[model samples]
Target: MSFLYFDNNATSRMDDEVLQAMLPYLQETYGNASSVQHKLGRAANTAIERARIDLADRLGSTPKEIYFTSGATESISTVLKGIAQAYNRKGKHIITCKTEHKAVLATCESLGKQGYEITYLDVDAQGNIDLEDLRKAIRADSILVSLMSANNETGVLHPIEKIANICQEKDVLFFCDATQHVGKLPIDLQEVAIDILCLSAHKFHGPKGIGALFIRRKSKPIQIPSLVTGGNQEHGLRGGTYAVPQIVGMGEAVKRFEFHSQIETIRDYFESELQQHIEEATVHARGTLRIPNTSNVLIKHVRSTELMTKVPEMALSSGSACVSGSRDPSHVLKAMGMDDEDVFCSSRFSFSKYTTNDDIDLAIQQIKRAVTQIREASPIWQMYKEGLI
Candidate 1:
């Protein structure tokens, strides 16, 4: 059976170009980036620096502002923890939303145990943070406000720009988890007024195990207090031997994204075609502004896992890859005010530039057939047919 992979949001398949760019680093150019005397070290450093420039360029930031780590989770932890420590002299309060990824939420939770207070802001029915609520939440004791740019499960784009502006007015530090949104959508740091931003490369067709954190120059200089205090690497924020090949691959992935302005166009087309083919499907276009590569749909009367099982050839997920095993309804859907039925029946489909129209058609057919098969066996659908639903 042929397979269709629609789970880009979980982790995208490595792009061929990225793999090609990383070949030398993995094969011949293997050297520690911290070495200063060896030619191999210089070569590795060159590749890493070039990749940094590519990522910085994509975000409209200088390379100096970009700090590499072992993917978005570490980057987020480093930033959140670093900011909290650096500014602890000022206050002990932090703010975030209920829909944040486990990385951000768990970090905040750990901080809460350490005497820091956290305020998880509520979202509207559309999965948007209320600016008025945010304004009320801001206090002199608030040290940081961490919000996600786009929700990992629902692809809902939060009003980060507005939130950042608000944080600025309140003189509070702002951090954004753009792990799901960075490469899939366009981001302008200067325009967004974000103080700190985090991104993972694998979510955008790059290799896993590599990510970057962007710290605004205006923010008080960050000192992570050393998560790994040895060798004094990653500007002393994170200390470990750098993964050269993965970083090189991430840079190449960013360069590839630069040429693909029409990627979102492809995703929009897929959404339209899917809507046309599946009458019972309800697409959750999170908010007015969503990343073009993602669409979460609720197909009533069919459980998301059941639909996936029915269509074994398609690679899809019920929600964020990180929380796939939880059995609990998606916190993102709940934050959006979705009922139990809607949340349980929802599945996420994310596209990449490599996804063609043919893939979309095949996915639509698979989903329709799968829904039909599941609904045929569903008691709710049976009851509806008997006028008992």
Candidate 2:
């Protein structure tokens, strides 16, 4: 059986156009961007600047504010650690929600061990943080507020505009880990007032090992202390040689980006079909604002691991790919008040531009069969059916 890919939230397939644009850089144009003495190096430098400008335009920032990094993980570390180090005299307090991606959470955890006061805001049942809770958490000594634009597991969207405004009112810098939000949605930094934003190109249709961080430079310019120190690259914010091909691919990906309005329709249809076929199957983060591509569904009493095992031809995940090897239940769902059993029973099926209605139809069919098979062997499922629990 030909395998179907529904794990786009983990990483998307690179676009053909993006790959074509990157070929020259990887082959003939293979000159170090920092080596500006030769013509080839000058050409490489010019391409990097062009890519930076294109990414900056799409992100609603200037070229000077864009800093390229390996990916969102590195970007998160740079922002959180740099901010803590640069602004330590102002305060040591930082705020973030419980449902953020592990990249932000881990960085915050490291900061906490270094004597930074980290305030973890709780989310409601639907995976939304209370704006009032955020408002109340702000302090005179609070230096930054870190939040993600969307949840990687549930696709739940936080009210970034309001959160940015709240942080702005409190005179705190706001950093958004937009790893899952950037290419899927339109992010106008000018309109949102976010102080810092980070995104990885592979989350879209670009190559891996390349991403960009956007810092606010216009009003109330803030300085983030350099995290990676060596050469004078990325305005001396991040140092090291640039990956020219990946950077070119990233630029092309952003240049060709067009939000697929049909993605939400396909996701909704998938959920509807799942609920219609699989008894007691329910969608997580339903009725909440989310990115169009993700659907986290709970198949009652059926472990997602078993379901995936039964349908080996379909690609899926229980939660973030960062912790896929871990046997632990999803931290995002646990934060949303779900029990560990139900969290294990849930699986995430994310789509991309390449996903189609027929693909979803086939996936639903396979899932229905898998759920039935799993539940047939599950004593818990049998007890639930008999109403004996």
Candidate 3:
């Protein structure tokens, strides 16, 4: 049986171009970027620098502002911990949303344990942050504000530009997690006025284990205590041997995605067609603005896990893969004011540039068939027929 992949939000398959770009570094140009005396070290360092330049160009930032990391998790951790440590003298307070990724939420939780004050701003029914609440949350002692550009589960786009403006006016540092939106949506740091941003390459068509963090040069430099203190890599912020091949792969991936206009068009087509053809399916569009490649649907009478179990050929998820094992409903949905039933019935289907229209059609058919079967067998549906649903 052929299988369809619709989980790009969780992770994307590596592109051939990116794989080819990484080949030399993995096989021949293998050397630690920290070793300065050897020719191999110079070659590895050159690849890393080139990759940084490519990523920075895509974000409309200078190469000097980018710092490499293992993934978005580490990038976020570094920013939260780094800024808190570096600027604690100024303030020991941070602000974030209740719906942020576990990486951000967990980091804030850890900081709270260490006596830092944290305020988690609430979201509206559409999963958008309240600017009024944000304004009220800001304090004289608030040093940093972290928010995501787009939600990983809901695909809801946040008001980063507005938030950044507020942060600027308030003279507080802003950090953005753009992991879900970087390649799928256009981002210009100059326009957004974000002080710091984080992204993981695997969310696009790049290999895993490589990501970047962007820090504004004008902001007071963070004397962030190192997370991995050792041989003075990544401007002495993160100290570890650089993974040259993965960095090269990420650079090539960004370059390709930056030029791919057709990807967005195809994604829109898939979303439009799926909404048109899937009758009675409550399509979750994540408010007015969202990344083009994602669509989360709540099939009213079917549990997401049960539906996926019946149709095993499609690669999809209920929500963030990080929270999959939990029996609790998606915190994102709860924050958006979705009831328990709607939350349990929802599933996420994400697309990629490589996905074909035929794949979309097939997946829809499979989904329709599965829902029909599940609803037919569901006691809840029977009760609904008796006016009890």
Candidate 4:
């Protein structure tokens, strides 16, 4: 049997166009972008700047405002830490939600240890933070508010425009990690007024290890401190040689791609079929506004690990890829008030532009079979059937 891939939120397969654009940089145009002496080096530098302009335009930013980083993880760390270090005198308080990616959560935790007061706002059962709570959390000492544009595991989108507005009203810097929703959704930073935004290209069919950050200037320029200091790369904010091939690929992917409505239809069909086949299946964030390709489902009495084992051909994830090795329940779900069992039984299925209708049909069948088998052998299911509660 042929396999089907549904873990696009974890990482997407690179598009052929992006790959073709990167080939020249790898095979022949291998020159240091910082070395402007030779023709080849100048060529590399010019290529990087062009890529910068491509990404900047998509974000409604100028080339000078866009700073390339390793990926979202690095970008998040840089933004959070940079704000913390640069504006400690203004205030060391930072506000963020509980369902954010580990990149933001972990960085905030680290900053907390360094004497910064970090306020973690609570979310509703639907995995969305309350704007009122956000308003209450912002104190006079608060200098920054970091939030994700979308939840990676559940594909639950946050209201960024409103969030940015609140940040502006409070005179706090707004930072958004746009890793999962950048290419999958229509984003115009010029209209949104986000102070700092970060996204990884790999999440959107670009090369891995290449991402960019958009920094907005409030009257004067925003001075973000450096984490990786060695050379003058990334405008002295981040140092090290540029990954020219990855940068080129990222530029092509971002500039050329648009969100596919067909994928959303397929994802909704898959969710409906799962609910029809397995009555116990509960879809997380189904009613909320979300990215088109993502669907996270929880089937009672069926552990995600067992489901994966029962249907080895289905490529899905138990939780975020970043927490694959850990045995803990999803922090994102836990923050939403879900019990441990709900988190463990939930599986995330994210489609891509390449995913077909046939793929969704096959995946639904595999998931139905897996859930049936898992529940049949589960003592909890049997106990519930006998009214042991």
Measured by lDDT, the strongest candidate is 2
lDDT of 4 by residue, 207-260 (tens): 999999988856877878999999989879989999999999999998887878
Q: Tell me how many residue pairs clash in candidate 3.
A: 0
Pick by lDDT: 3 or 4, better one: 4
lDDT by residue (1-389, candidate 1, tens digit) is 56888898999999898999999988899988888589999899988999999999999998988989888898788877877887788899999999899899999999999989999999877777889999999999998999999988778888888999999899888899999888777898868889889999999889998999888786456455655567777677778888999999999989887436566777777777777876567778544677777888888778898988888888889998888998999888888888888899888988777788888888878878877778777788888768896
Cα error, residue 249 of model 3, in Å, equals 0.7
Better of 2 and 4 by lDDT: 2
TM-scores of the candidates are 0.95, 0.98, 0.95, 0.98
Candidates in order have lDDT scores of 0.85, 0.92, 0.87, 0.90
What is the overall TM-score of model 2 with all chains considered together?
A: 0.98
Model 4: residues with Cα > 4 Å off, grouped in runs? none
Worst 10 residues of 3 by lDDT: 258-267
User: Model 1, stretches more than 4 Å misplaced?
Assistant: 259-262, 385-387
Q: Which stretches of candidate 3 lie over 4 Å from their true place?
A: 259-279
Lowest lDDT sum, 10 consecutive residues, model 2, at 216-225
Q: Which residue pairs in model 2 clash with each other?
A: none
lDDT (tens digit, per residue) of candidate 3 on 182-231: 99888999688999899999999999999998888884564556777887
